[model samples]
Target: MKYPIMIRVKQKQIAQLVSLGKRLDGRGLNDYRGIQLEVGVVGRAEGSARVRLGKTEVLVGTKIELGEPFPDVPNQGVLTVNAELVPLASPTFEPGPPREDAIELARVVDRGVRESKAIALEELCVEPGKKVFIVFVDVYVLNHDGNLIDASALAALAALLNTKMFNYEVKEGKIEVKPGYKPLSVKNYPIAVTFAQIDDKLVVDPWLEEEQVMDARITITTDKDGKICALQKGGYGYFTTQQVLEAAKIAKEKAEELRKLVVKG
Candidate 1:
């Protein structure tokens, strides 16, 4: 499908400028747009957060419940992530089951958190191989200006950081609720940075316009230790080995910057 003439013109203009380390939004090639974050947004949720990256916005809520652990990971708790692209968020989105983009978004976020071992699942187990706590991370897109993955990932992490565990006691395989609550054990902080390849140059936190003109996009996720935990590539374009390595280095630095914003000491 061909983009309308105006869109093509915009694409060409954006791409030309990006080749010169410039962006239509006045950001440098490696600069991210403004970010705003708020935690504990949902009173009824175990944890919740809202993150706005440029014009893009995402909300994440976490719910915890007692459930059986997976057979293979019987000793550890479960972590599941789901994403919804609300119709009001974008004209392109419609109300229905999760589309491919929504599924991909959830998977990317899940990989980052799971690979980094951000949540101390082992500590959530009530009984070995019998019962455990299940953490559900639900990501909702409230606006779609681009960089949804980064915003969603940040919100998920922030929500998890704000998560509180219910106090309970196990007696004869039965759980008894207690009056007090405790903070969830989060062992690591993982941050995701997404880059778009436009005019052969990679730009950080591409806005909606930049994303439409990009060749490929790749997301790099790093843990609290500055070690890479996950990587996902999308679009039809491919990055060279050197490009990937360079992106990794930049991603490490960017992750640290983003982590500080979402994680408090």
Candidate 2:
């Protein structure tokens, strides 16, 4: 992935500025771009949300249905995640099956929610082993400024928070769907914070240009208790133990800040 000559020159300028604690966009080294969140954007979906982080935008939709339980987790509900990088979102994105980056995005977001136990899946069980609820979380990238991982994760969590599941009843040893709907059971809020390493500086919420020049990227997902739930590292660069620890500390604070925008009373 070789960039153009102009891009290479710009990358050098960015690195020089970063060494002096300055960014091309005039943001502080650790400062994040502006974020905006909207839930219940898709009326047809059981749950849905849209998130904007700087120029990046993503939409997440949650669909719930009754299905046979998994062999091992028969008593608990199931959760599946899928992500699509729409070709129109970015020039580099192509239309086709899921790519490696898209697959990794889904897995990272899934791990954050699953490991944090954000949703009360047990309550979705219609029967002990015969039937249970299945939640499908689908993420779509509407814009690709950079840092899709964090934006997609935020949208998924927000959609889950706005989810409303249909009521159900059991009769004659069979589960029956009811008309009314009830809010999905949620237990925790897990948010992911991402940083891009350019030269020796680690910047929060990298934009498109910064991402292209970055040496590495790290995303850390944390729960409300400020405990790390999941982590993903990208690019070929390495991070020292001290760098990882510092990233976690920064993730905790930023996660809390982002949580306030999506979580409601």
Candidate 3:
């Protein structure tokens, strides 16, 4: 009873504020909240990174293991991404198995990294069809402040950048692990930019409150070449052609700006 009424009141106030090109957090429509990144946090994992986007916090860990390659892509390594939505992150999260939201979150980040070809899979191949190194990317959501897609993607890329490969030698059809390690061969960098449509205006990196009030949302991921590698649309709303194009233009610029933070060059 009162719950529904409170929701409506909040929605109205948020809509009215966005209608005037302002956000509840005092940011412009295109401005994103402050982002903080830390790499090499987990000592045991091959690579690890944590990202703080406003109040949203996400951590990613990368582990490399030896495994057989797929029959079709025998000459390439395999990349698997998994995401966990801890119940403690948000009250809405449950302690059960993986939910649809968690699956979607993992897929979105996976697509951005896969489509961009950021990792050199062929280089990880050991013996063509027989042996290859498998890279596992695990995403851990420490806090749910909205825009999980962008935050996870940022952390994933940062983790990959910090990843290290074990030094080894192929001796008589077997891999002999050495004492040193080399950095993973990372090529392109992909950055995801998310927008939420509220009151006919698009808000960049919408926080939890804006997400609740947004009519529809879209995420555009761009590679280092300023090309869109992946895009995800959510909510029950449509965007005009001009709006899509406008978002693309912004995606390119924002991707570059964000990439600099992860790549450190």
Candidate 4:
């Protein structure tokens, strides 16, 4: 999230437009751009999804493995999330270890699902503390226009919905795979909405141009029950109390629209 020279100049211009009650892309302060989502995009993965938000593109794949549950949560299954920012995604992204930006993206998406209780972990448990299904959610940033957080979250949720778990039977302390398969037990739907602060205005779904100039960003995740599940704020900017409330209202309104796209397997 380092600001380059050109990016800083563009951000200043966007801030000026925000002060005039306008956005760089001419979208309303609370309007989201068109979203495109597709499930089962990767044939090799058990479950996969791709999401495009404006110019940002993200892909998610889910893989399940049988393993012992965590000592603290033996009765429940485990959910592990990881994110990768390929060097080809953006010039700033390197080829080696993950940077802070990638870590933050993974945390934001993971918190939304974990806090929302979207997955029925207990259903994934096979034998209390002995064995359980561990769900691995991997997110890859194919393109970095802006707003990777929102795109990644959408892809993760969609991939989870498309996942199919193989039936298993425990015999003589050994787990055997059954012939039939069942869809992952998804208990709730969670959607994330991101807002960028430019000057004094908060704009929803900021494109790369606007993001380069914005001062701060906020993401809100809400469940199908209309309950706020998680909140994350990024960048070195300040938000007033009133602005935070206003952003929440906008996020709640937009979340419902996006939640409709999460298909059940």
User: Each prediction's Cα lDDT score?
Assistant: 0.93, 0.92, 0.93, 0.89
lDDT of 2 by residue, 1-265 (tens): 6776887889989999899999999999888888899999999999999999998999999999888888898899999999999999999999999999999999999999999999878887888898889999999999999999999999999999999999878999877778989888888999999999999678988898998999899999999999999999998788888889899999999999899999875
lDDT of 1 at 237: 88
Tens-digit lDDT string for candidate 4 (119-224): 9899889999989999999999999998898899999999999998998888988899989888888888889999998887898888888877778899999998
Q: Once superposed on the true structure, which residue ranges of model 2 sit more than 4 Å away at CA?
A: none
Alpha carbon lDDT at 95, candidate 3: 95
How does candidate 3 score on lDDT? 0.93
lDDT of 1 by residue, 206-262 (tens): 998888778899999999999999999998889999889999999999998999998
Error of 1 at 196 (Å): 0.3
Any runs in candidate 4 off by more than 4 Å, and if so which? none
TM-score computed on alpha carbons, candidate 3: 0.97
Q: Distance (Å) between predicted and true CA of 103, model 4?
A: 1.0
Q: Give the TM-scores of the predictions, in the order they appear.
A: 0.97, 0.97, 0.97, 0.95
Q: Looking at candidate 2, what is the lDDT of residue 114?
A: 95
Which residue pairs collide, candidate 4?
11-213
Clashes of each: 0, 0, 0, 1
Candidate 3 structure quality by residue, lDDT tens digits, 1-265: 1234566779988899899988889999888899999999999999999999999999999999999999999999999999999998997788989898899899999999999999989999999999999999999999999999999999999999999999999999989999989999889999999999988888899998888778889999999999999999998788998999999999899888898899874
